[model samples]
Target chain A: MKKRTILGVRACTWVWLIMMGLTLVTYLIGQLGLGGISASLTVLAFALIKGQMLGDYFMGLKRISGFWRWPVVIWLFLPGGLISVAFTLVG
Target chain B: MQAQAVAEPIRYPPGDLAIWVFILAELAAFGAFFGAYAFTRMQHVELFNHFQATLDRDAALINTFALITSSYFVVRAVASIRDNNSQGCVRWLMAALVMGALFLIVKAQEYAHHIDEGIRLSTNTFYMFYLSLTFFHFMHVIMGMVILAAVAVKAKRGGYSATEHTGVETGASYWHMVDLVWLILFPLVYVMK
Candidate 1:
């Protein structure tokens, strides 16, 4: 497969805008005092979205083989599960 | 070039796999810490909430942005090397290093502010975990900067090419891993009110 050149400024601008939007949503959610479950969920959602962006664009994992990709996706979930279990057992 | 003729069914470099395994092991260690943090938080939700309120969310947010943007530049560095743009590659790597340094400086400022507010690592279990985990993450950021600096030096010396930029690729991969860890850490530490 022919490798594509690095993204130009326009594409980077779009990505930056999307990321900023997510960050803003996160800030607004925090400010609204949404309590534990909702706030946690919102944060987790934003983290996952941001993680996907980082993985696909910043890490260039999108072009890698599945053998390399699957493990990373799985690794990302370990913390999420562990944190949820902790919350369930303790909270 | 002659090595390619042996035709040993080219595998993803063992060195890269070894690094991935090491990264996975680190993830497990961090998992244990997260588990502990969650368990303690469950037992003392109010205390954790109070502690969260004390955290500098704005600074954390800024640091998050910095790291994520740095990750983007690291990716660009890798791509530029593949395009045989050595100067471009060096420039991006330097940008990444600068951004990573900015994150550490902001983090230090946040730490100072926290200490001034009487929230030392020993303040409570929550603060203990918060300080330990973040400080640990900070160490990774420092290590990443070192790696990027090395890559920048190599790029400046024309040490990479379209087919042999594995060093740049691996360095960028490691830096991205640092960013990935912080993505989760930021939400858990700052937004979990």
Candidate 2:
């Protein structure tokens, strides 16, 4: 598995930092008690993106062409979409 | 907004094919559980939100960070072994193991708090789901750490090389799956209301 580097730092390092940042953002949202469908969607959006990055970069699925790469992405979006719908029905 | 790949050869999925199959199965099981939670919460919004407030979000936030960082450490381990640096690989694995241990410790504290409150799986709907879902994931972290330990011991024994370190990838893939699940689990269980 060839790891891509950016300006000397490994790509995984960058991904890790971004993931941490996103986690904090979600935490802040929770801490602020932001109640609404939008806030829930925002949190789920962050989580799904983090899952995608973990699958692609950390799991090394990015380097692969097809099949395997799609499953994780599908796994991510499938539940995410369903969960979002579930939340929206809170109308 | 992502960068292009460095135009390397088509690498197969980092780990064995069998592992991916197992991973998909695990994901399906988790997906079902999450779906159940979402629907159940929909039916009992007040109950869910009330119990969700009782949870310690700070500990969950810390655990989320711990798991993400540990996943990165595993990525480094894979890279190190790809360079045939078994020692570096071992070091990274050990770092990952430490992070895993940290996650467990924090989670254990959360569980202790719950137990002290006399919370049980039969306590209420929210507590049942909370305890069952989280404890299930907790066992996974424990199992993931054990897998990483085994891989680190193998690396220290010089059992892998640049071309033969699928074992590392396999372990990493498993760990990342655990992390991936937590990525959803944290926000789903702890944050979203």
Candidate 3:
């Protein structure tokens, strides 16, 4: 195995573990029935964090040190912000 | 006098630029749908809340884990291919495919239950968004499976190498996109109160 491949595998393993932990945490938060504005924002925050991890690690965006990084970040915030706003207004 | 030299940037997007374009388009479409869902929910807060209560949160939670685990498996598959281990890559991808199949089976059962309960697309605004968003995502999962299956078959046939495994990366990128969508969709549609 190449050196880079070894390093890549190790990095991805750690990211995957973190993502799983976050998923469980998000589910537990939802189960708390913290309804209304706070719950919505917190859930959206979890969604954004998970999505960013997938993009950076699994999608290999973190390796790229150019303008390519911004697109994924923008992609995450756009919908997240919109949903947050909607939830707040409805509440 | 001597001319000065400059170094080029040392970064490139993963898999293929074409796929990133496709990923962006898919995300945009989903974002629009989610925005619309939020808008519709705001307009009919009571209706959305009442029907949202009817959704199977347990099933959604289970599906969430399935996708997250599958995504991890895909990462492993990509790592295997990166090391030029074709057989290992195939095995990892096959495992991911099984998880994807599990997701589809669970989703199919959920759909069956809805159908049995006479929950059509026109049932209500909430159900409309529910069925539309989830079923849309359901199809994406199947599509991602097909892509992964192809990658796995190619890898099994020794079509990829450490230096030329872009196919595996491409498929992994699309699969991760599917997982990303579900990560957001699960909370917005299922867990949000």
Q: Which stretches of candidate 1 lie over 4 Å from their true place?
A: A1-16, A88-91, B1-15
TM-score of chain A of 2: 0.92
Local error of candidate 1 at residue B111 (angstroms): 1.1
Q: Rank candidates by TM-score, best first.
A: 2, 3, 1
10 residues in a row with least lDDT, candidate 3 chain B: B7-16
DockQ of each: 0.42, 0.69, 0.66
Residues B1-193, candidate 3: write the lDDT tens digits. 9988876554767687788889889999998999999988888988887888787787888889899889989988888888888999999999999999999998999999999999999998899899999999999999999999999999999999999998999999999999999999999897787
Candidate 1 global lDDT: 0.78
Candidate that beats the other on lDDT, 1 or 2, i.e. the better one: 2
For residue B107, what is the lDDT in candidate 1? 99
Docking class of 1: acceptable
Candidate 3 residue lDDT tens string, A1-91: 6334354657677777777787777778767766789877887888899899999888878767778877888988998888998899878
Docking quality category of candidate 2 according to DockQ thresholds: medium
Could you give candidate 2's per-residue lDDT for residues B1-193 as a string of tens digits? Answer: 8988687656468778788888889899898888888888899999988899999999999999999999999988988999999999999999999999999999999999988999999999999999999898899899999999999999999999998998899989989999999999898888898
B1-193: candidate 1 lDDT, tens digit per residue: 4555454443342225666676767767766777678777887888888878888888888898898788878877887888899999999999989899999999999988888887877889889999999999899899889988998999899999877888897788788889888888887877775
Q: Kindly report the interface RMSD of candidate 3, rounded to 1 decimal.
A: 1.6
